[model samples]
Target: MATPPALVFSDLDGTLLDHHSYGHAPAAPALAALRARGIPLILASSKTAAEIAVLHAELGLGTAPAIVENGAGLWQPGEGSSQDASDYRRIRAALQALPAALRRPFTGFGDLGEKGIAIATGLPPEAARAAARRQHSEPGLWTGDDAGLLAFAAALAPQGITARRGGRFLTLSLGGTKAQMMAQVARRYGAPLTVALGDAPNDAEMIEAADLGVIVRNDHGTPLPPLDGEASGRVLRTALPGPAGWNAAILDFLKQLDRRGGARTDG
Candidate 1:
């Protein structure tokens, strides 16, 4: 594949999409600019491939792979919805193998069923079904105390299952991060300049790894603490929240790149 000037990796729920409505209409302008400039926008999220594929097609990303299942897997364009679920199965098995005391506190998607997922995520029934079709990771609520959570993680460590706390859930996977996937995608595109935008702690690695990082304001979730990049002016925060903030931060950054004669206009 030919190299583009830059690759943009973004988190979906609380970054490029609204926290409550899950809409991206507010980001249309920046999305248009990216398309015009030939910059590929890679959706990086904790959402499943089944879930991400819908939005990926809606956005017309055309063949760009997405980081799905919280980076436990990649969703290549045209790939079937029935992806390999071995990893997800392994994660589930590991959870089951834990002592009952530890296992009982974590109610994963597999345990929740479609209806429970719908209630938990506030997604429609159909969407919840899609979200439940996990291919690589297990996200669940951790009801145990902090010490118990720590013990749970330690017990799972022997099985190569790591836990990550996202905005609302504790996710368990064999362990690939958004930043790791970002680097892989960048290499596939010939290592172009990278930009990452997100709104939560799980997004921190990806944001910090990028050449330019954006922390889209997300008043609905735990605020990400100030990162080191902010002091260097390499990372920026938005005044608006969700897609609106995403739009403004992206446009402003691209403009700054243009001013510096660094924005790529050629394909």
Candidate 2:
């Protein structure tokens, strides 16, 4: 049996890395297995490029591009391209321009500085600084009623902005989403069998778009909203949390794929 070329698109904070500990130690086996199979692991995260780049390097992913800032844009290391880098200033301006009622309850990282970000995210001062170096998106805390949140998002939509509720904050970015970026990357790789894992609603689009959608369990014990798509039976849910759940799903899927003879096998 043969298998199609495959790649994995994953969320960071709660999918590949732990939510509280911020480590992927539990998924080490899966990480090693993916490397062994020569699979391309693309990071799709709400974290800024500066933050994703640091983790990517530590993971030994050499110069591989990442989908950063909640898909506000992509980051290609060593390539002096991508217009997303300069979009932050404009985004901030847009936020301020929103009606005072729509904007007042939200406090973004840009407004907080590194120290604020550190306190908000529980990252150390140094790590928080990296998180604060946002290029394409604005992640912030929303301190308002649900109705106000909806109103804010609606207001931003007319201005080519989007608000996504992440695990810890509400992220504002350009209209792009993980699904859009995932499609672009899929094209770059000749449209191989795509597998995506995520644990939050902000990730619903990408998860539904993948050939194999895996909803990993989150630390809060709440699963994401239902992933609606035309591809039935292609979506799956993991029972374990963090990387352990991530590992379980990938291994299980690979076994099913091998049996189905969907693509070329690495071994």
Which pairs of residues clash in candidate 2, taking residues 3 or more apart in a chain or in different chains?
A: 2-263, 3-263, 3-264, 4-262, 4-263, 4-264
Q: Which candidate tops TM-score?
A: 1
**Error in Å for residue 111 of model 1:** 1.2
Q: Which lDDT values do the candidates have, in the order given?
A: 0.88, 0.82
lDDT per residue (tens digit) for residues 1-267 in model 1: 777778999999888988878899999999988887788999999999889989999999988899998887777998666657888899998888889998888999999999998888889999999999987889888898879989999999988888877766788887688999999999999745899999988899999999999998878766789999999999889999899999998898789768876666645
Top lDDT: which candidate number? 1
Q: Report the error of model 2 at residue 254, Å.
A: 1.9
Clashing pairs in 1: none
TM-score of 1: 0.94
